[model samples]
Target chain A: MSWMHTIFALILLPAIATGMFRILRGPTAADRMMTAQLFGTCGVAILLLLSTGMGNPVLLDIALVFALLAALATITFVRRTWHGSNKRNHGNPL
Target chain B: MIYSILTLFDIILILTMLWLAWCLLNTEDIFKAVVLFISFGLLMALAWVRMRAPDVALAEAALGAGLTGPLFLSALRRMNRTRKGERRLDSDENREKEHKANQEQG
Candidate 1:
């Protein structure tokens, strides 16, 4: 069982690295946002795998919290993007 | 033997993850990239399941793949339309001049 955790970490490490590259090097703001979301999700998965490998239930709450936070961050980004474009369309009445 | 079987599944899961990651990186269209990223999230969930982390798998499927992916794609679509509209608003004479300039420069 412990080996399984190690295996997953090894498997996911490269994927996470590639995602980080996208987050850093993405050409557009939207690309960076998507990459950041991917990284957060992968982090949660890693935490869960580690928690289970160690037979500890406490980490489940951490995973949940991380998921909620990631969702909130994505929502904020979406709202900001929408508002920015709306301003552009309306000719910046402000 | 059971342990070996489990390891084999893990290997397969890892391979799938790599493939998804490749797709996410190489897709040209932003919309397609978002879709591939979501698929990558789903594959990650399966990888977690194979590793015996059901809780993580659920979170990955729900929050990672499900909510975030669609949110990003819709946002991208809106951004694309706004950009297109801005370009369309440009006067035709200006557009033609710019096109001619580009041809001359190239």
Candidate 2:
């Protein structure tokens, strides 16, 4: 049973790896931000699997923290970084 | 069998983290580098969990991925603004110099 949890966690590793390629070559800042979002979701899943496999309930809290913060990063990117750059494109103040 | 499987997982996780750090540090674009940094922090948190350090993992996820990412993004914006401001000042100085030269020539 423990092995199952670990195995499941191992399976998610490839998805994260593939996502890194997007981060490496993503043309737009938004693409890179979206990839980071993917990382947050996958990290949470991996943490949950490891928590169960190792029988450490504390990891669930870490997973919760990850979930809460992922959105925060994306919101900051859109509001502060992305919004300013797009002002010229619209030719109006946002 | 399970022990060996866990070891394999650990090895892969370590390798991935190293690769992420490498990419984040060397990327040409500041925005890409910052985004890569956020993901690297997320992986680092996972590594902390694997190492049986839940407290560290919680801190890493919250500060490393969450707070630091936005902090860097805002800093990048500030940097770009200052750069634009400097360029504008330079152009204004150049225009003043040109006007003085034209008056003297006329």
What C-alpha lDDT, on a 0 to 100 scale, does residue B34 get in candidate 1? 67
| Tens-digit lDDT track of model 2 for A1-94 | 3888999999998899888998888878889889889888988898889888888888889988888888998999898888866564437775
lDDT of 1 by residue, B1-106 (tens): 4466456656755775777687668866665566567656756765665566777777766677657875776677566865774553256976898799889999
Candidate 1 predicts chain B with a TM-score of 0.72
Worst 10 residues of 2 chain A by lDDT: A85-94
Where does model 2 sit among the CAPRI classes? medium
Top candidate when judged by DockQ against the true structure: 2
Query: In candidate 1, which residue ranges exceed 4 Å CA deviation?
Result: A85-94, B1-106
Best by TM-score: 2
DockQ of each: 0.05, 0.70
Q: What CAPRI class is candidate 1? A: incorrect
In Å, residue B47's CA in model 2 sits off its true spot by 0.8
Residue B47, model 2: lDDT of 81
